[model samples]
Target: MEIKHNPQLTSTELATLWNTYMADSMGRCILTHFKQTVEDQYIAEIIDTALQIAKNHIDTITELFHEEKIPIPQGFGVNDLNNNAPRLFGDLFYLRYIEHMGRTGLTTYALAKAISSRKDIRELYKLWYNQTEKMFDMAIDLALENGTLVKPPYIDYPKEVQFVENDKFLGHFFGKKRSLLAIEITHLGTNIEVCNVGQTILLGFSQVANSNELRQFFYRGAKIGKKQISTFLGILKDNNTSYPSTWDSLITDSLESPFSDKLMLFQANLLSAIAMADYGTAIGGSVRKDIGVIYARLMAELANYAEDGAKYMIKERWLEKPPQTHDRYKLINRKD
Candidate 1:
């Protein structure tokens, strides 16, 4: 992709580039480990593709930052990776992880493209978004072939076009409620799967974390994720709808840390942030008042979890500050 000369990057463009750089850098470290640890040839190929994409994004973002005279973030790298550590996740988990990440990348890059005014930046995001779409398709295809993908529950086809006749369709507080709407079921099933993934990842992190404090934090996160999964699952059970299978059983008993404490903490917090966003989306898509209420409550818990993780990162000096405007008040107070 050729870069056209333009004015200084807009705040939204800078924010999106900086965020993508940080995520991809961290992803590079994690994917490097996955590529090294994976045994299956087909899975290894997918991991390699993901790792290359991460590295390419990091390089492109660094180049853009240099051109714009913005300092690059000190994102994760070889120093934060443990090449000798044993694998913490099973081969199947790698596929699932890639699929999940690719799914997220599509959303992130689409939004980045939408908010960007610079032609070069918009094109970059569009390119990456397409790449992610292909990557996600690959993962999904393989998962389907392996019979590892847990699909959303199917609902009977509507026999005819029907209109709501009563306000009760919105759900009731005391009496018999209506069956789950397709959108409601979709969000509930998706959130349950995300929680399961978070729970398993945190469980692996907790086992290998070096600091006791970090270990406890990861354990607590895993426990909360497990509870959230159960809550969603219970809702599905009420409708007799099936949900995705849990990934906890796929975690290994490895005690050796594959990633630094800082990296692990960042990843855990990132997952929590994603969960909160997912819940908010769910709340919006849902029509049932009770379902929305449940999502709202979960969002609050996830917010607290993410905040604590941010504080911990700050305390440890592991959090890298993003680009921001100069403080006008500080400038005004300057004596020189």
Candidate 2:
């Protein structure tokens, strides 16, 4: 396909295109995984709905690209998948992955809507965002039904500190002497590192993606990471903690090529999940309820994003299949 430069493609337009492409590509990948592992008819229905949304978006964007006479970005296709591979995870873990992905999709769609300028693109985003929101709700319900969602320990009030004085357990030893402010500072630093890592990954992937939409998605994600880093720094300073030095290492600099879409999505989702867990732990350890709440929300958002990415990986056959358990066998001959 001959590529044409459409100067009318504003930054926002480019971003929307990128998000649409990524979402569609990943969604198709996850749907394949769901078809192989999901047992319950109801749960399968929900997964199907999500798949439909992704497919629809892909079609819509393709049409848009055609209308604009712009070349659509090349991404992973059905040929890249191997859905019949041996299961890699249990059914419970698979459900958990889907639940997380739905949440992530919602966040990404919402962010895209906020930044997009063209009415046609914004309208398309609104439609997909609503679809993602529905998918998230359905995933949560399915997770609850299947008992797969992780329930964080509920704490009603602050508890007394108990120091574990063991040199081998570095976390325990360091945690004992650290004030709440100090711990918050450490968490802030970690968050900054995660954001930087994510940005680098996205930037590297963006440079290699053939689709304009894919590149834009990475750029948008990079922008979001920058904002998040700024926010964390502000919180650190407000709490009278020193901000950590900026991350200067470029993981992508040594690489000459772009990552495959499946690989990129997998890495992004995995990183987001790790960050979510870290943020959640920070919230639990923080003394300030307000700060805790903020971190908690951010963690939730990241969790959702990671889950979405995981679903796509599964569909693409990049991830392993979840395991299945059989019912207990009856003792047919023991009665004699």
Name the candidate that leads on lDDT. 1
Stretches of candidate 1 off by over 4 Å are: 1-4
Instruction: Put down candidate 2 lDDT per residue, 1-336, tens digits, no spaces.
Output: 443443465666675576567556765765665567666677777778877887888888788878877677655566535555433333444454455566556766777878876666677778888888888788778767765544322223447886657543322322233333556666677677667666655665566554566567656666667777788877765545656555433332332232346655655665576577668777776765556777877777676656766675676567643222333464544556
Q: Worst lDDT window (10 residues) for model 2? A: 169-178
How do all models score by TM-score? 0.96, 0.50
For residues 101-220, write the lDDT of model 1, one tens digit per residue. 887898899999999988988889988998888888888988898888978778888899899999888896666778898889998888888887888889899999999999999999
Full-model lDDT for every candidate:
0.88, 0.62
Question: Can you give the lDDT of residue 196 in candidate 1?
Answer: 78
